[model samples]
Target: MKYRIVEQTRPGGMLAQVYREVLVPAFPPEELESEESLAETLETGLGSLLVAVDDTGRPAAAAFGHWWEASRVQMLANLAVKPGTRGHGLGGRLLRDAVDAWRERYDPCLIVAEIESPDARMVHEDYGDPRRRLGFYESAGARVLDLPYFQPGIGGASRRVQGMLLLVIHADPTFTPERLDRLSGKLLRAFITEYLAAAEGEPANDWDAKALFRAFDREGGIPMGRWGTRP
Candidate 1:
């Protein structure tokens, strides 16, 4: 089947509707209505919206990214795919395209994502489970940054426990040590203030960055591939 990523405002924006109404419903109660109010939440000057379509032109999956310029990072948001169409690897394709688009427009940028803890454990457990979403990203050379924090909802409602992952795909390894340090500092601050800060009320941001760094620092760095692989 054919696959393409399109803006959410295209002629068939109904694809977004299908994802919100159909795909999101399959999430647990806690996540059921999360995207319902995204229209306003996602209205931003620097974020990108993407929808994937099947050969018949049906919407198969969708994802978005919010650009954090100070950190030279793009935080991936709202990734979802229709249940029936999930196992075919469309998710990975869509994600790769998203990364490609990011590189095309904003090269030398870092790709980041914060997923819930349960989702992470589930991904680690599944055998060839299409939900093993992180693997595709790891294979694409994304690094896992284990920032154990929760993501807050509007008005500081409830917090969703999330862990952050980073993919420095297009980084300029030639940058000076000082420049890299500055960039890393900015990214870390944004990760705290924007993502981790939003989740403040639910739980204390008790996880130390140094501890997380040691945990995720390795030869391959947390095995972003299939679950059966050695960590």
Candidate 2:
């Protein structure tokens, strides 16, 4: 499969179908960003758009990642495979390719993903099983962090993003616990406030720790991978 950069920079192609037919149906209302927000995000220069194409030139899978310059990392924001293309390992291939691309461009120390927590508590439509999702990332060398991270609300929406698991794959062998803690905060702020839900007159995610702590309650700094949660 050929990987192409599908952003607002280059339009009038398969991106429309990928977003509408593939992503819109794949993600729930809260998780899926509106089309306008997506285009605006791509215009910000801090994020990217990537699509994996088939032999016939159809867009098979697509993903997006937002850049955190301070930590030099990329947050794998959204990844979705076309309905008919699921279970062929396309999701895994797309993720691996995106990680390689990020490393080639930025040499980031880590790649971050926030997934549904592995416990059977929270659920969603279509892709509701948390372990199934986390297991996929684990197979790709990603570990489910024990951090109790919370995703801030999306844009003006009031729905809270709950039951999150922070999954990270690191490139830096020299990373100390202190460094990882610092990295986590930076990424959360960038992705939560600046990119995903920056509303008018509101403080960035950095300034909202009190609110965040109350909202998400992710204070413990456990760094261990929850391998025991795997099926």
Candidate 3:
């Protein structure tokens, strides 16, 4: 089904409704950002929201991305489809729309996303299977970066979520092994620095954030690989 794609750079309108109905229920509390934070990003021109509205004007999927000036990257903060709208490629369509929009607007050096690592070694996770989700992103041309990743608390009642993997969904000048290896540490450190400051107030204060920054600050070039196949 062809859905209308809407771009929102500010709060109110369908943004709030979609956050309440689609995102709130689709993601776990710790994984989702507070509505206020989401709004603030949009209001401040740091982020944008793309919604796939069905024929009846109901949002079927949503993708939120924020631009990190320090890293020249656009982070795919969240990509979700309504429970009933899954398996129809709505999420992929929304993701593509987001990439296109961000590319045209920011021309970011890289478009990244945080995903649940399939190696998390858990069977009863609240969200769906990590393996399937990993497959979804990989099929979309995403390459997983080798980094010890964990999400900082998103404020409100949210806590940090660990065992996550960062993916480069899109990159400019494309990605050569040399470039990937050389910039892995530099890019990740900057990305997380900005991300941590936004979500946790102080990047150096959060243990996981600080550890990640330090670990990747001067680390060697990291390899990129597909799921179940990392070098």
lDDT of 1: 0.52
Which portions of model 2 show Cα errors greater than 4 Å?
A: 1-12, 120-125, 177-201, 204-222, 227-231
Residue 154's C-alpha lDDT in candidate 1? Answer: 35
Looking at model 3, the pairs that clash are 181-221
Task: Choose 1 or 3, whichever is better by TM-score.
Answer: 3
Question: Sort by TM-score, best first: what order?
Answer: 3, 2, 1
Worst 10 residues of 1 by lDDT: 122-131
Q: Write down the lDDT of every candidate, Cα atoms only.
A: 0.52, 0.63, 0.78
Over 1-231, each residue of candidate 3 has an lDDT whose tens digit, in order, gives 669999988788788888987888777778888898889888888878899988889888889888888788999999888877787888888888899889999988889999889876644443567888999999999988776777777761146788888888887654344664344666666777777777776545645555666667554566677866776
Show the lowest summed lDDT stretch of 10 residues, model 3. 174-183
The order by descending lDDT is 3, 2, 1
Model 1: per-residue Cα lDDT over 115-134, one tens digit each: 44324544322122333556
Task: Indicate whether candidate 2 or candidate 3 has the larger TM-score.
Answer: 3
Cα displacement (Å) at residue 190, model 2: 7.5
* Cα displacement (Å) at residue 164, model 2: 1.0
| Candidate 1 wrong stretches, greater than 4 Å | 9-12, 15-18, 21-23, 26-33, 116-131, 152-158, 162-186, 196-231
